[model samples]
Target: MSSTQEFIDEAAKIYKVLSNSTRLKILYYLRHQDSETDVKTMVNDLGLVQPIISKQLGILYRYQLVCRHKEGTRVYYVLDDPHVIEMIDDMLKHVKHEIKGEPHPRTLYDNKK
Candidate 1:
């Protein structure tokens, strides 16, 4: 088993990666995509600039949270991290609970033995 400090550090790292809304939206969009997409597609779909999308993608790629493929001069990205998907799902559930005035799963689970 890992130390508590190690777990804390890992959570902090994930939070850092997810702190940007652009990254979150990118991940959300990619989750439903059937094929790997390029920066231009993201820029067009998300209405964000190329540099912003590319920068967020770079961060995700650096953390190995996304898969990158190169075809000739173009690069494509796909959401590749199951843990990131779980985190996103959990966060969305928590937000839904908050909106519905219900207990969050995290809080309930944390209070359990």
Candidate 2:
């Protein structure tokens, strides 16, 4: 396979991981936090069950999207990449503009004159 195809395949895998709403929520939650958060706190704050949060956290950790540390009996997680949050924020801005029927702000990739 060519390098371009390899890049596309890897990008698709990342999008697949980010496509989960639960994972997105977890990312967003971590983004606003000042420190590492435990699964139990996420379960309580996000109103999700422990297993579901744990599973999603595992996936996020595997993707290198979140970092984790084990202290005592609890495992805490924090956002590993701010770039991921920025991407999500930009997409959300695009979505908001779409919903409001507003023009999209010009990006570096915009080709219009």
Candidate 3:
């Protein structure tokens, strides 16, 4: 594969991380939050157990899609690039349009007036 194909292949790996519902929910929450959070915090905020969160986080970290920082004994994570947030925001817009008032659905609205 050429360099461009290699880059696309790497991007596909990143997509694999985002492909999981739990992982995407985790990223969506963390990215929108104003402050960074540690694994324990992620477990609590996501209502997921420590081990599952850790495993998902490991995948995200491996792809360099997440930023990790240590303060004291706890490690906090943030988005490696702000563009990830932008991407999520763009997708959320489409989701909102697709699910608007639909039964048994997820809905999001932007107050960008």
Kindly list the per-residue Cα lDDT of model 3 for residues 1-113, writing each as its tens digit: 79999999988887777779887887887777888889888888788998988888888888777888889988899877778768877777778867795443344543343
Cα lDDT tens digits for candidate 1, 16-80: 99988889999989988999999888898999999999999999998888999998988899988
lDDT preference between candidates 1 and 3, better one = 1
Error of 1 at 55 (Å): 0.2
Model 3 lDDT-worst window of ten: 104-113
Those runs of model 3 whose alpha carbons end farther than 4 Å from true positions after fitting are 100-113
List where candidate 2 sits over 4 angstroms from the true fold. 107-113
* lDDT accuracy of residue 92 in candidate 2: 92
Q: How close is candidate 2 to the true structure, as a TM-score?
A: 0.91
Q: What would the TM-score be for candidate 3 when compared with the true structure?
A: 0.75
Better of 1 and 2 by lDDT: 2
Better TM-score candidate (2, 3)? 2
